[model samples]
Target: MAMSKFWWKSDSSKDKSIHWMCWSRLTAAKCKGGMGFKNLRDFNTALLGNQAWRLISFPDKLLNWDPTLSYIWRSVMEAQALLVQGISCCIGNGQTVDITNSPWLPSIEDPFVHSDNKAISNQKVISLFKIDEKAWDIELVLDVFEERDAELILSIPLTENDKDTWYWRHEKMGHYSVKSGYNVIQASKNQPNTVDNSRFWRKLWNLKIPNKARRIQVNAQCPVCNLCDESAIHSLVTFSFAVECHQFSSVKQVAGDYHIFTEWLQMVFEQSNNRDICIQEDGLEQWCPTSSNSVKVNVDAALFTDPNRYNYAIVVRDHLGHLVQAMSKCSLGKVVSRAIRECRHQRSP
Candidate 1:
């Protein structure tokens, strides 16, 4: 009597076989390979760090404090701190301190001292500091600077006086408010000149969209899919395929009717994979026959005069050189009819 072998009966044996198979497949040809395995704990730690950095770098986007605001104050502050720290490190022998104390170092003397040790007298320092503070106030002056720079670059109709007036008006106006009397300062220490008022009205009226409103519009839809839900690159590239598949399935009645559509959909989905499965320039099709199945599947890209449109066709032929089933015209009817016609033709021959 011959001894019978139960190969997968033992857990340890099965586990070992599975492990060996996995590694063997990974080292296989690029076209026929398994997922390359990584240390799970290390990967998880790296992923967690990436998430933390994203959160820190895009606080407003992640936190949803004000959906209408594009700039994240906290993130910007963090970035500024990072910049100051880096600059301080480069200039000050790797010592990290407050921006004011380390690199900025305001002088206790009649004049404040810069990192360069330039002696700016108290009165001169105070005046320069005030002007510099106003000019460098990122939140207050960025919009003004951008607008003026754009006008200058584009060669828009504006004189030096007009530009100065516009700047002064913007300084007086401060930040915008959707409230009335916000711009009307009857009298103040920082009152704008009459020329500034004239430029202010012209520029303010010309403003097509408010930054806040623009931000709101931009954030209304998901960045990836342009859907209302949370837009993620993974969702658009990966999960959306499943969603589109489900949508296609809902419309398709027959099983194999969706084969070509699914294949095309997958090609579109995995486009980032950079593996060109389309028919090449030589007009040759990718025809590979499998021994396990007598039927041969031919995948080819259909060409049209229009370059913008992408149309693909997949055909499955029976072992007897007959088309048992077919789908075309973005519907199941054409393929089914083709299949029937081929079947009848085979019978007749």
Candidate 2:
């Protein structure tokens, strides 16, 4: 720690005012409102934790005469103790998991330990899995747990392996590394700063569309305002006349001066929107010929310069390139009938 402070002072050339932010704040991650400086203390702890985990998980390796007798090994034990705070076990055949104590369940709360059956105290989770249907033995689970807890246990996927796998919750794919360890430490201390402009922006987004989220659904266009495509993020946050409404509300100065969308939501929302923008119908490669016995329907529409009008067409093709059905339509009035015409003129399906 002293060596790091010495290096910091040398790097800064003894300029006190130019340091601007404190050492701790600068050491945080950018996403968590830090300057991206590496937190050496956390970094050291993370590295030590990895070694400690290895020693604890594997004891028979090198230096056979009691590894804990050494100072380095003892220091590593301290780091390992801290690392276990963020560790959880993924239930497999569940041989290694202690069902009552291990942090295997996905819920925020620990597994309920007040089971009426004392026999299950040390039993492996795999004992509860039914191989026939590749699912948990629901009756046995319900015997030990309430309905809600039983549902959560059943949701976790069980593997055919003979042992459970340990995972660092902060890391990806259940694999631990020094970088992830450092991140875990930093996140433990991270506190949201509401003074920043980003905080106010987060509240503006309308995220109450639970129905669409549950059914894996999204609307083609904004439900309240038909001009822009409706999304769970940006479009939902705004009405069609947001500018007018905000301007009229006497808060235009505060709203217009800031950039669009909230700070935290903007970064995440844009990334999700970009992934779905790929064109699935690229060309003729996607067009496969109909099967010998079954017919295929092909429908397409062309948009017109008028917002209310469209030159729409639909056709069905047979296995032998025969036209089984055909239809065409165009709007004759100012009404936005392109969508309505497409649905109603579908051969009354």
Best by lDDT: 2
Q: CA lDDT, every prediction? A: 0.34, 0.63
Error of 2 at 67 (Å): 7.6
User: How would you encode candidate 1's per-residue C-alpha lDDT over 130-195 as one tens digit per residue?
Assistant: 232322233322232344332321232212221111001122342222111111121121334523
Provide the lowest-lDDT 10-residue window in model 2: 250-259
**Stretches of model 2 off by over 4 angstroms after superposition:** 1-20, 55-60, 63-68, 107-119, 130-135, 192-349
Candidate 1 lDDT for residue 27: 28
Q: What lDDT score goes with residue 341 in model 1?
A: 50
Candidate 1: misplaced stretches above 4 Å? 1-216, 223-227, 237-239, 242-288, 302-349
Please estimate how well model 2 matches the true structure, expressed as its whole-model Cα lDDT.
0.63
Best by TM-score: 2
